[model samples]
Target: MMAHSPGDTAFLPSLPQLLIDDAVRAALREDLGRAGDITTNATIAEDAKATAILSSREMGTVCGTGFARAAFALIDPALKFEALVRDGEKVSPGEKLARVTGNARAILSAERVALNYMMHLSGIATYTARFVDLVNETKARVCDTRKTIPGMRAFAKYAVKCGGGANHRFGLDDAILIKDNHIAVAGGVTNAIEAARAYAGHLVKIEIEVDGLAQFEEALAAKADVILLDNMGPELLEKAVGINAGRAILEASGGIGFDTIKAVAQTGVDYISTSKITMAAPTLDIGLDIEIA
Candidate 1:
């Protein structure tokens, strides 16, 4: 089953078996290509029985264990998958998170696909947790942006939540954000804000992106619900906040790094969004060592 979103009450007791099936199927087709597992086919009996443990090679948060198990379970329903650690729990190098024992071919076939998603998603969660930790004592909440892998945004956002970060719009439909290009196209901030408010549904909030204090004041004058103060240093951000005076939700964007995030948080923005969290987060170091037992 997919891990529940943080604070989510809804439970996904089991994923549609098809998600696991399709992901594994595509992975196997890619890895096998035209040759199949040549070494396994050549050297090992098709029905060879084996037992293996899933152990971590680095200290980090555990994620996607269920999905990893789902990968193997898809290959062999009776494959023993015992998860010794829960998703989102901290783990150490050499710690055993799960054990799988079943047909050797099934275990070998599912290995790579299982490791790919687990490592990738866990990396996202780990890095997000880092940013979350950076601002734990402050008022700002770490958030992830649209800079996500194309087909895996939902899973990526799920990982962000697992790491104590919140998700922005899953896509364009959920929010209306007017940027520099839109302001230029519409002739000015006034035109852009007016057009957005007019064209948007009542429930669709309007946020305007401004690059400097002048634009911020214009945006506040235009009555934007959220003002994305782009690349503003803490001093300017403070000035912008004083200008805004609680009339809108203040969001800080651009120039955000671990060194600068806490100071930006101190600038009194409600949230800080960054593509760096997703684009720059390295894949967590994780591996599966399979041995016959």
Candidate 2:
């Protein structure tokens, strides 16, 4: 993980090279299948060389450059991949993002896999940025939830950071989040909180979800480190904040979209976690155009 920058809220620490290489290698393996780029091998000579330019077709925040580079490098180590803009930077339509110069066959083989990562991750970053922009004036920070595509949680969460949003717990093991289901299973909010508190190490902070004021009071009395106000509208959220009185970190979640996020932020919650940033984001249109020379 990269160090947080106080000045650039959108600054993202680079993902570990090993993780990037592993993901890219898997994607390339899947794409290549039993035989590798048969079309390229049949049509383009192995000695053929060319330059390909990656350009954005729509305005969006850029991400996953390292993944793209890894794709090309793993395909052919001699290939040169240069990123014109860093991850987390905003780009306009038709803006050139990266240039790849080397064996034409290698570029062709890696194109789709590279674009697949860039487009999907950039879309998440773009969507997350919109939510971040809407809530910029408030104390509330936009956050990404666990509702991510399986096997891609880390990438999705990294995209959220690129878009100027904070990440929630990466997985269930990282933190103890007592949701309504947990509360019900444990008999009550107080019971769940107490059980979690007793089981958790001193470094682990416990967060509980509550839908109404009564549950909120129980969670507060139980001394949960963080309280999630689930599906509550602005009015109820504001009231919850008043009830909280700085005793715990407050997060408002559920049914939050671009339309309602601003209102929710103004309710004085510390964070707003939504799945739309990752699950519902459309792929940003980016294309790779080869310039054979």
Residue-level lDDT of model 1, residues 1-293, one tens digit each, is 32223343544222355665676667667887897777777877988888777777887766677678878887679889888877666677888878888888888877887888888877887787778778777777788888888777777776777666777777899999899999999999988999899899999989899999888888888999999999889999988888777999999999698899989988888888987777887887777777744
> Which numbered prediction scores highest in lDDT against the true structure?
2
Best by TM-score: 2
> lDDT, candidate 1, residue 179?
90
lDDT of 2 by residue, 1-293 (tens): 22122245543556889999999999999999998999999999889989999999999899899999999999999999999998888999999999999999999999999999999999998899988889888888888999999999999999888888889999999999999899999999999999998999999989999999999999999999999999999999999999889999999999999999999999999999999999999999999998755
TM-score per candidate, chains pooled: 0.89, 0.96
Question: What count of clashes does model 1 give?
Answer: 0
